[model samples]
Target: MQPVEGSDKAEILKNAAAHVAKAASSGSKIIVLPEYFNSPFGSQYLPEYAETLLPSPPKQDEAPTFYALSTIAAENKVYLIGGSIPEFNPQTKKHYNTSLIFDPEGNLLAAYRKAHLFDVDIPGRVTYYESEYLDSGNKLGLVDLPDYGKIAVAICYDIRFPELATIATRKGAFALIYPSAFPIATGSIHWRLLAQARALDNQLYVVLCGPARDTRGTLVAWGHSLVVDPMAQVVVEAEEKETIVEWELDPNEIEGTRKSIPVSAQRRFDIYPDVSAGTIQFEDPKLEEP
Candidate 1:
């Protein structure tokens, strides 16, 4: 769930803690929160809300969102993906839209900053220039779970890049989890399509969590949190509301789909002469090979 905007850190943590307790009591082994769950969605206000990692001065008092995530993982004995947080990089004096993974024992497994910034001009309505306030990550982030195998983390706008998901799949991720707060305009056309495409292309489970509907009406999010199986089928989906969508996933499905399609084996990397060079092109024939 998206933590209410403009709420105090303490209040957000309390709500998250309670949610964790409820999920644990009902037997959920893993939970994913929406992107920027701790604060509202705006670049201008990020500096006031940004935080540093543990062992920093701000961490002495304990970051409410981080503390909540650790507590939730420990208390539930479940894996938790603390979606994307506005993390401060003191050296650069810039914030990173970051995602952190916690194991059942509250161990920090991996942290990933959003590599791709949202920079677009949407004509008349809304424009997001994420680079104005955030630094982009350079590498892929992955974590392993005992029962679920390896999982990869990607933030909101990252879903549009297929290469990110391809790299994760190549690195042995059985599933891809994206915590996003996609705008209603884009979400209506691209959210489910991207999710299904990634699953079908990589033959891995794709799980997405997003902010619930906003009655405040400033920017409505298309809230359809869902789990797509290896066959690119929606196993289950949550309504356009604040809720959880749960499903039983079989790790073996990845292997099964891979075995059936064998796309990995069929890749003709050697046949492509451009592999030796540093450039590859995607332009269609302009003159039709006449």
Candidate 2:
């Protein structure tokens, strides 16, 4: 959705509230929004928009965005994965692209600071460096949804790193969800491929939510919000319009795929070190590419 002219915090949040309510009315138990849902997908404005949540002040007046998400989750009784937010880190004096999850009770469940900062120089195409302004997360995140079981989560660029999904799969995550904003340059080609690769390799379901296409700004987004099944097929997708595409996932598919391939059980750990834990050693291991 395009932000209204001179978008204020309240208006940005009200727009989100409307979407959440609509999803709930359609019987969606779990709702996911696109990355940078409330703010424009630009780096310069991050500091101005970043805010804190729950456990702290962010000031006496709570961060309006946080309050809005929590209220919506509780009132609607829907599990909400609030897309990415620019977060201010006081202790480190840095900022991060952060994703937050809220339970139906309006309680904070999980937080994943985007680890793989988007930095690519596709000369003649598009160039962006999230590392220039955003601090990277040092760890991976996994959250368990009561009736639904475990689900792994990462932001846009983080999806390109297979290690994140591998670790989550080992920890029993049957599905993965990413809130993303794929710029037109890369999204046109790589968006769906990455989603399909992650799901196929892990034998799990993969869901992605992205902002609908809007040509007003200098930057353009490839808008094809989608979900992939364990079978590695695009189950449902949305056009450039602002709409919700919902689908049900079956765990049996995951079991069946893994059982047929058996790649998860047949890993040759003796030949290569396990990456499932995704631990970081004191010195980063460096190797030349194959």
Candidate 3:
């Protein structure tokens, strides 16, 4: 969906809620928004729009965004992948780009701070330095839903790193979702290529949600929200406009693709060591209803 640059937080919440509700009505199990859904992109607005991650229902003014997202997810009864937010990490005394996941019951399931900071300069084309204000996250973000298989959440620039997605796949992730916003300069060149490559390499579904192009903002988001199947097929995609995209994914397709290719099993472990050398821990995630 499109965002009016510097729009009121209340208005942004309203727009997001409306879009999410529409998507749920269409039988979408999981809904994702673009990075900086409630604020303008870039580091300039981090000081103004960043919010702290707190328990639900703080003093009226505390965390309207988090509460709004939880309430919307519960009311709609759908998994919510809240794009990215500039989060104030009290412990670090700095900000980070964060992604929050809420279950259908509105419980906060997982929070993933973006590890990859986008700091690049293209001379006359475009120059962005996310590292100037945003601190990078060290850990990865992977979660498992009751019905759906595991999922890995990666914010914008994280899409460029396949190692994160590879690690998630080793942990049995069936799909990967990236909430991203690429300026028109890079979007035209890398957006589709990256989406297709990730899906093809991981043999999993890839869902990329991008902000719509807004002329009012300097960061020209290449708005083309898309979904790619395990076979690297573009099943459904949205144009450069405000729209809700929904599609039914058949799990058999995943099984069929894996069985036919079997690249996952045929990996030359002797030549390429297993990435599963890392530690593993399972938490009985609190499933209490909200």
Model 1 poorest 10 in a row by lDDT:
281-290
> For candidate 3, which ten residues in a row score worst on lDDT?
281-290
RMSD (Cα, Å) for all candidates, in order, is 8.3, 5.6, 3.2
Winner of 1 and 2 under TM-score: 2
* Per-residue lDDT of model 2, residues 183-250, tens digit only: 89999889999999999889899998888777764457777899999988999988877777788788
Segments in model 2 whose C-alpha atoms lie over 4 Å from true places: 1-6, 54-62, 91-93, 278-290
lDDT of each: 0.75, 0.78, 0.80
Itemize residue pairs with steric clashes in candidate 2. Answer: none
Error of 3 at 219 (Å): 0.9
Instruction: Give the distance in Å from residue 10's predicted Cα in candidate 2 to where it truly belongs.
Output: 1.6
Candidate 3, residue 78: the lDDT equals 89
By lDDT rank, best first, the candidates go 3, 2, 1
Of the two candidates 1 and 2, the one with more favorable lDDT, higher being better, is 2
TM-score result, candidate 2: 0.90
The sequence of per-residue lDDT tens digits that candidate 1 reaches over residues 1-290 is 44444446667667767776777778888888888777766676578777776343236353566766877898889899887788877667888887878889887777777889989878765677888878887766667777777888888888889887877787678889999988777888888899999999889999988877775645666788889999999888877776766777787887798899898788887775322234322112110110
TM-score of 1: 0.87
